[model samples]
Target: MLRLLFVGDVYGKPGRRVLAAQLPLLRPDFDFIVVNGENAAGGYGLNRESFDLITGAGADAVTLGNHAWHHKDITALLNDPRLIRPLNLPPGTPGRGAHTFEVSGVRLTVVNLLGRVFMDAAHNPFLAMDELLAQPDLGTVFVDFHAEATSEKAALAWYLDGRVAAVIGTHTHVATADSRILPNGTAFQTDAGFTGPLHSIIGADPDGPIQKFVTERPHRFSVKDGPAELNGVKLELEGGQAVRIERYHYEEGGDGSAAS
Candidate 1:
């Protein structure tokens, strides 16, 4: 059996903190780790330094979303062949959208995608996912459908039932309680949550966002620096079937967000 761990979106420094603190504890149990780094760069884009940090933190591969290009050189960085983008990108896009990994003789394939409705123009995720689903030599598969709507996430999970091991949603920092195994043997969740500040608002400074909202004034967004907590999902899959799905939240000392 191959164990797959998918981390929620990493917002900023706070997200980075818990990520670094928990990997050593989780390394022995998870063979492959995937993290969403789109928001790791000052809460907007994934910078080169952040990318290196995510990899250094035990991420076998990193996935990106709509905010992927927030950094300057991400276009060139995506060419390194290590990072993956949305599979539904228009023809001739730079980075790969999907790839396969080998772990303990189990072929694990991971695909990243962006949503349509209520999002920037991207290829149809459903069509893009179907294309990858047709590929062969597939043992276990994981889909990071970075999206904005919960309905979209759920619809995609149902569409991929019995074909892939898991269909996990990202992009939203808020954690959802819908993690479960589908009737068709696939694990699914609306969102894995985020690995960042607990005291702040939605992974940001609670006061900062609150001020911006209450005062109706433009406030410079900054990373919420407080207790950091790591959040994500751990899954066990064998022969393309998911046997278990779990959500994990870890904090640093007393500063991190309490587990729900």
Candidate 2:
């Protein structure tokens, strides 16, 4: 069996801090580590420094979401094979959205796809996935479906059942309660959730979102402070099939509070 740790969206300084502190204790238990860091930079987009923070904290590969290109310099980083953006992005999009890595004699391929429902315009994730899976034998395929709609995420999971090892959702910041193996052997979760301040609204200061909601206007958002938390999933795969998918949660300062 091979174990992989997939961390949900990292919000900002709080997320990175908790991750750096907790990963050292968690690393020994997993064979591979992947983190979603699209919002790592000031809770908007990933900058070079924030990217380094995530990788430095122990991410083998970093997956991104709709905020993938918020940082202008990230354009240059599109060439880095370890950084993956959404595959459904236009053909000319700077970064590639899928990558394969070999670990401990086992090959694992990770793909990122963005959902069109309630999201920015993008190609069809189902068709894009079909093209990727059509390639000869992509060993132990795992997908990070960065999407908003729960229905869309679940539909894709069922669409690719047995064809991939796991399909975990992101972008919603709130982790879903559903985590189980599909009828066809695929491990599925609606959303992996966010790994950052838990007191605020989805890692941002609650005031901004609340005010915006009341006024129906844009407001400058900022990363929230206070108690931080780390949310993620641990997958146990046997022979390129997911046999177990479990949620992993950790609180800042190690006082021990499960992710809510």
Candidate 3:
């Protein structure tokens, strides 16, 4: 069985710091790993250095969300063939957001899709998913539906239940408690939370976000440095379907101690 570990959104340098420190220690547990990095660059978009850090930390592939294009530097990262944008985006969108590969003789396919409701103007993720599920050779397929609305995210899980191996949601930094296998063998979760600062405000400085809401003003947000956490899920797939799945929440140890 192939163990796939998928991490949640990384916020900023502090997020990157926690990611770098935790991933290496968790590598031996999984065969392939993925990370959602829509906010790795200063709490907005990911950058070159941040990309390198995450990939260096052992992400087989990195997926983006609505904020993927927030940083201009991503123009180059998208060209690398490893960095992926949303597959549900308009046809001309750059970077391959979906790909198929092999691990220990097992075939695996990963697709990254962005939700449309309450999101930026993008292609229909449902239609895009139809095309992906059409492939017959895929043994185990995984989808990262980066979206904002819970209704939309939940619908997609049911939509692809019997067809795909798993459907995971991202973008909402809050982790959802509903992680379970669908009747059709697909593992589902609304959100995987985040792998960044746990003590701060939704992965950013608490003050700025609070001030903005309180004052009704635009505030340039920043990452808050403090204790950190690595959050994600582990899924075991067999015969192109998930047999077991579990969510994870690991906080950085205080006083120089590490979390298990």
Candidate 4:
């Protein structure tokens, strides 16, 4: 059996802090860890510092989303083998969208893909995945579908059922209750939620989003700082098929004590 942990989008210093604090506690239980750190740098995009911090916190692979290139210096960091960007980006785009890691003698392929609905234009994820799976030697596959719409996420998961070990969604910053194994033995979740200030609006200060909503104008948003929470999913796979999947949630108190 292989146990895998997939962490949701980590939003800023708060997210980083909680991740750093909790991973050590959770590390021993899982064979591999994957984190979504696209918003790790000031809640905009990842930077080298954020990348190192996440990796140092026991993440075997770090995944990105639509904001994968928000940081001016991120282009260079994308070349790191442990970092994965959206695979459906235009050809010739820097960084790979998929990476393989070996743990306990088992090879796991992690793929990151962006959704096109209500998001920036990108190559068709379905076709991109088809091309990727056609390549030889892909072991027990797992996907982080960073998308805006739940339907899109679900569609892709169903489309790829039985072919991959699991499909977990990100970018929504809200955990959905629907987490279960598909009929074909693939684990699926609408969204894994996010790691950041629990009280804020999707990891950002509520003031900025509220102003934009009320005034109908662009407003700058910053990462919210306060008690934090970490959200993710735990999966157990046997023979490249998911046997179990459970949502994991942890909240931190002001004094930094964590509660599950």
The prediction achieving the highest TM-score against the true structure is: 4
lDDT of 1: 0.84
Instruction: Put down candidate 1 lDDT per residue, 1-260, tens digits, no spaces.
Output: 88889998898987876787777667888889999887888888788888888888899888999988778888887875558778888899888898788887888888888988699999888888888778778668889989999999999999999999999999888889989999999999999888787777767777778889999998877788878777799998887989999988776767344454
Query: What are the lDDT scores of the predictions, listed in order?
Result: 0.84, 0.89, 0.87, 0.93
* Per-residue lDDT of candidate 4, residues 88-185 (tens digit): 98889998999888878888899999999999998999999999999877789999999999889999999999989999999999999999999998
Off by over 4 Å in 2: 253-260
**Candidate 3 wrongly placed segments (more than 4 Å):** 258-260
Q: Using TM-score as the measure, name the better of candidate 2 and candidate 4.
A: 4
* Candidate with the greatest lDDT versus the true structure: 4
Point out where model 1 deviates above 4 Å: 215-218, 255-260
lDDT of 4 at 97: 98
Worst 10 residues of 3 by lDDT: 251-260
TM-score of each: 0.93, 0.96, 0.95, 0.98
Inter-residue clash pairs, candidate 1: 227-255, 227-256
Q: What's model 1's lDDT at 90?
A: 81
